[model samples]
Target chain A: MSEKRIEISQLGEFGLIDRINRQFTLKNESSLKGIGDDAAVIQASGDECMLVSTDMLVEGIHFDLSYVPIQHLGYKAVAVNVSDIAAMNGKAEQITVSIALSNRFSVEAVDALYQGIKTACENYNVDLVGGDTTSSAAGLVISITVLGRAPKSKIVYRKGAQVNDIICVTGDLGAAFMGLQVLEREKQVFMADPGMQPSLEKYEYMVGRQLKPEARTDIVFDLEEAGVKPTSMIDVSDGLVSELFHLSRHSEVGIRIYEDKVPIDHMTFETAVEFKLDPITCALNGGEDYELLFTIRQEDQEKIKKHPDIHMIGYVHDRKNERVMITKQGNTVPLRAQGWDHFTE
Target chain B: MSEKRIEISQLGEFGLIDRINRQFTLKNESSLKGIGDDAAVIQASGDECMLVSTDMLVEGIHFDLSYVPIQHLGYKAVAVNVSDIAAMNGKAEQITVSIALSNRFSVEAVDALYQGIKTACENYNVDLVGGDTTSSAAGLVISITVLGRAPKSKIVYRKGAQVNDIICVTGDLGAAFMGLQVLEREKQVFMADPGMQPSLEKYEYMVGRQLKPEARTDIVFDLEEAGVKPTSMIDVSDGLVSELFHLSRHSEVGIRIYEDKVPIDHMTFETAVEFKLDPITCALNGGEDYELLFTIRQEDQEKIKKHPDIHMIGYVHDRKNERVMITKQGNTVPLRAQGWDHFTE
Candidate 1:
């Protein structure tokens, strides 16, 4: 055998995905689309299509177990996957969760984790179906796959955005990212002096957003209720700008937005200032918000304009290969996707 | 923190699963069923129901990297999930695959794995939709979730079997187990003397069964074509006797089988003998065959008797609590389930 070795970090996550995806091609008629999307869409019988999405959360990388409750971790796992399904404009019906844990977790700990998972299942109205529980050599790993259903006419893809579609997002961004910073700070403080109780009561909302984010399934339902179908959609898992680039690339369109329109909670803004992180940058690049980002026809805007949670931040444009954001100070600059890159430092 | 530590092996795999599942309760109308079955069935908009199944394969416990190819591992991961969908008597439509690997893996290694995944997706006629790629601290882990669809009338569950139903299974068993034994033996031999070539040619058939076991999707198709819906169905992932126990427990029906009727391939039998193992025992207790086990109404037997791969093994009985096996010597004994228990010694 040859003694050549190559590290995965050299290729990075996206490079690795590209390499792997290049070898496989879809073979089934039922498989409407594969890989390179928020969720995979399958051709189901009748006028409905089935959407499938999967996500894996690893200990240390995705969350720090020191501060994250096992139950919240479980709930967050399901929520993230459901968020992906919601990104495809589908209602999640079922989810299967697989976890690999070390011996450090007790039966009580396992129960707590399941409690969170059960709560999320209830909240999202999805059934917890089949999953495998196994032992891991290291920290915990949670992988969940969610199944969703959407009418063919209402189903949205990342590639369906038109040149002039209005870009919309649900809920405020950057809270989850800021919440993570607070948690990490508290953890460090607790570690340094065991006697000092970390003050977290004032940051309850941000902390909740970080520890247990909710999937925007309600937005999916509201879109249907308002008789509006998003031309393109994606859940904000990898920052707002990263997901926007995905939509722009897949739909072959350009995007332009105003920084003032990006929703950022007041607490998040204050916390960002305290943490010495730019509020706008955090909103654009800090991910795990579980908010829906989509495009709507200009005529349909009137229907969802009344929704308090939905924020119209940008518009799709015909200028291909350009995605820019206008600053509050009147400077226009190109948007770069500095999303979460797990591989590179 | 008080120093109280418990090893996961203390509770074992099933015990852990039970502990985790006990905390979750279904709350959605769309969640027709959850956790316990081969797949979770969800109510879709149409007459058809959606099925979801998930499986996780861990390194060292599930596969040995020394002998197993990464590509085959990927294929097996998808195949196992497809088998779960087939057990529900549904047509698999979409799958989400999540992989976690350490930096030791190369871009080429990742490609090999996905190549196998893509091949299986094509062969099973299922689409690979969405998944997560993350870095791991240890060996590679693959988790797959499959989504399937079938009309409510055609869906089969483990609890549907009745007394007097004919018990049937597709393809031969024990080949994969025997193949694993052969591989282990060769690995030992090669480890002891690097210059000696592996005596693998004679065990090629058995080895293939271990390396690339196909899911019994064809049985699902054949049953549909024959217009015979199984009263109860399950895939043989854990040994045959274990699966029998599952059917018996779920359907609340007794089962009786003849040892002579169990299908054992010629290569498996020969290899088992060479390894000083019982072929019948291997057929009963060996796993990873990915075969289908089902019960059919006695009157419908005539329709499938002509099918080449499907084999009649036994019949369901009114003795709900008794599950027995008849030996070649005319002796009857209770069957024990010693399936793949990773936690057991």
Candidate 2:
């Protein structure tokens, strides 16, 4: 074999996506948008269109069966896919879930997994459409594709942010990351001493955040009701800083955020300190929070200003590569993203 | 620890699907059909509807990397998903391909896979839409979701076959199964004697059939041109008899076929005989044939009668569960589906 071998780690995930994306050109007129966005937009009706997004969660790579409940895994699978649709400012209506698992999984185990899936379907008002089920060689793999609907007028892309647009994020950040820390710590303790039971009572909030994160679809509805469409939007799945980089690049704008304004739950902050981690760092880099992060036009900021859950953390500016954060002491520091790279890790 | 453990193999794949299907109800108005057809039907526009179908291919469970080229595997993955859309008598326009691979695969391998995916996209005239790329702990897993469009009037389901309807199948069958046999035999031979070079010149047709099965989208075009609508349709992915059983159960009709009329290539027949296997049984129970199987009205038979690739193999009867095949010697035998059950195997 004379072929040159280039390791995938050399390109990394995003670089690899860029390489693949460069090769294909959209041929169908109905395919309004393709690979780059959170969800691909397809023309549906006269003024309405459909949004399609997919996510695959592998067993050992994405979750640990020993610690993560099979049910929560099912629910999280649906939620994360739905979050993609929500990031597009659309309502997810249908999903197809395909699962591949080894024979080690039982019928009762599958039932419990589906139980969580069904619960999520009800909660999100999304219908289960179609999927493939088959056996895997090793552990479980869940891949879900979600379809969403929105009027063409209401659709927002990540490339639409203008100068001086206010950046807003829904709910507190880093709680899910902290929750993961707690779960991992508990698992380690239980593994060290088999007879000692795990005590999760004190970390229930953060633990639940990690186990059963919700897509911020309600925020999409709230913004619509308030007549304030986000200039640009994205779901915070790969850390706040990483997603901000995406918005900045796509929108071709700079970003300025205050570290003091970054939302962090009290429990998350306290736990981060206890774990000898910086709360601000966790809020910026810790991922899987499934929160909506978006930028609104300066004129529309007043519409959602009084909203309890939404926080105004930053603003978009004209300088393209000048992303920075103002510390509590008023020191301007360049913001660097330490996003999760599953491949390299 | 006290929970009852019922193995998944006990229920088989179809039984497990039934159990999962019973627990959910479609609530979205856009969800016209869910979970029961080759593709889920969603109301898109006035009379225009969209079809959604998904399929997942696991490395070891579905294909062996030792013999199968990664590029061909990628093309086969897309083709199978498109075949599902073709089975529904719809034109597939967009697809999302999500792949999970471990570090064992290189950047060059990933590029080869995407190259095949791109070629399929061009061949099918389908747009490459959104998908997830993630790291897996083991072998490669490819999950593809396809979106298609057809007028509601032209859409066909699995439950529309009428009594005495003529069953037509596109292209020849069983070649793919034979191809698998040849590949597996060569693999074993190579394992025993590593220096032996595999000479597959005589088995090219069958080998290609197994490695890169083409979807019968052209047949769908031919049927449209002939102005014929199939009463019920399904893809022959899980053997001809298994698909017949699906149509029978869904349409509440019996199936009767002539074994002599079943199309088998000379190469397939010769190969099956060489392997000491029954050719007719291979045609009956051999899976992975991405051919269209549908029922047409008696009046519409002449429209496609002269089609070179179309074979009139069977007919639908009034009595449910009375499926049988008449052998070349005129002896009737009960038709039973030995469909592929990966879990059980």
Candidate 3:
């Protein structure tokens, strides 16, 4: 109640997370890993470790209901949390979703949301095991907790990357950010002239990327099929550079990546140019990619090197706390993290 | 898009829950239970069961910053979910807390919130696991998920009560509801006259009940110590009678309780009388007690009859869905559920 007003923006999201992590210590033996990595690892039955991760999405702040379909919002909610479990090199099996909605929402609206949740459950083979639904004072809120499992030997941590490990990523990046840009611009156009039909035909793929992002559980499967256990793994929810910084900090290693090797979809690149923005910048800092970024030892690279979806982008180095990008012009530059920070915005 | 507007209030909370429960079927073998209970039960390793429960508290909807301390709100959030785990006769081992706050709050405010969270974790002996922290466009929102474990043979569910089982509850009830009433009244008084200093000394117990309710994990420990496995169990969250209706519905049995047997704290009774409200009505309909309500086999009655905090208020009967209360004068009246429903409010 004191007037000492220190804005949350001053500390930012990761700084606030660090402050939170330092305050609590794990007391229970079952809690193998606490407030670090993508999920908390707990001792389960036999030689397997259970994985738990949580994500919360707020309406208006995280999504504008005007442009976002309720069904897609529900599916994205589940997918993001499942992606955290996938980041731990585990298979998500169950999810508990909690939503708080204002009465302006109808029963039909609720059903539409659940339809999306059920769709995600079917696609990911994850069961909707538990959830809490309540009335909110304002906008809708969705919080999901995903439960997953992996063998103790196979479970990966963000701190396991070592020097000479090959860094890999799944699919492409920045499409979702471009998709959001197109949607926002189209919404503005529609608002200015209600009679004018917005031309969205050419931006379908980008729009879909923004409207519905999928968790890369398939990559987790592929890694298993290739018999490669990633030395370190993390999901790319908070952009490429930010996540790379997390891996670097946690693993006590440095990163050296070729900027040209970073995968960017053609649609994403063209749209960035149309918007008068740098495509590389979008790829590096556009959050919510929901792709997998991981590292494997040099000896293990042959297993997934030829896999079409997997792209080798970088290597871990001995110099700790350093990250750089080698450009197509053969120039090295320091990497900066400009990931999503909802508080400041 | 349809002109049809079916307000969520039409179905009510339980009706809405039933609608949600009907939509999702448990697909995985690990998922043993979903919805309709205090917590969901999942299969754990080595003949053990894991209990998962979630609760979300939205500011303005669930609490008011004017009268409720931020720290107490943080503690109450964690306690409610831990109480759900205890309802299943399980020990809560880990909890994930996710919170969203607007910029109106400061870094010191967040620290106060987490300070309360850390206090509760130490008190309950539960680990602070993984969670998400984001920004809300409006007021604060806290969502907590508690994970617990119990032996397969020991885990209690709501659907296990049988005829002639003694219905019992731990500690007292109805105090928390009265506490909220007192706090709201005091808040209104202060708002009406800015210069007026509100008096709350006489209502400390009720105020404490509303602000810092504790989870009855001690009862869980006691039941283990007494070698008593409750046939059915639930936490007293939404008043005594409403939770009784749930027991009757789930166990497929009738409930009959003596009005005089319901435990009411002395301070709670006095405060209700001073407010010109019926104490018994408050006892039956007042909620947020965080107490354990369970049914023990008649044969196990002797084990806990002398236990100071345990109060036997009712018994299970064969006539399904017939819930009644016997007055102090021996008159029988049907019991109705008017428990907390935020949507209708």
| Native interface contacts retained, candidate 3 | 0.81
Docking class of 2: high
Which sections of candidate 3 miss by over 4 Å? Answer: none
Clashing pairs in 2: none
Taking the true A–B contacts (Cα pairs closer than 8 Å), what share appears in each candidate? 0.69, 0.92, 0.81
Cα lDDT tens digits, model 1, B1-345, are 235645667778888777767766777677787877888888776576888888888898789989999999998999999999999999887777889888777777877888898889889888776688998878888998888888888899999899999999999999999989989988999999999899789989889999998988888988999999999999999999999999999999999999999999988888788789999999999998889999999999999999999999999998988999999998999999889877654
Q: For candidate 2, write residues A227-328 as lDDT tens digits.
A: 998999999998999999999999999999999999999999999999999999999999999999999989998899999999999899999999999999
Candidate lDDT scores, in order, read 0.88, 0.94, 0.91
Q: State the lDDT at A221 in candidate 1.
A: 85
RMSD to the true structure for each prediction, in A, is: 2.4, 1.0, 1.2
TM-score (C-alpha) between model 2 and the true structure:
0.99
Best by TM-score: 2
TM-score of chain A of 1: 0.97
Candidate 3 per-residue lDDT, tens place, A202-232, comes to 9898788788889999898888989999999
What's the distance in Å from true for residue A66, model 1? 1.0
lDDT digits (tens) for residues B1-345 of candidate 2: 237788889899898899999999999988999998899999987898999999999998999999999999989999999999999999999999999999999988898899999999999999998888889988999999999999999999999999989999989999999999999999999999999999999999999999999999999999999999999999999999999999999999999999999999999999999999999999999999999999999999989999999999989999898999999999999998999998888
Q: Rank the candidates by TM-score, best first.
A: 2, 3, 1
User: Model 1 Cα displacement at A258 (Å)?
Assistant: 1.8
Return model 1's CA RMSD, one decimal.
2.4
> Tens digit of lDDT per residue, candidate 1, span A217-319?
8998899899998899999988999999999999999999999999999999999999999999999999989899999999999999999999999899988
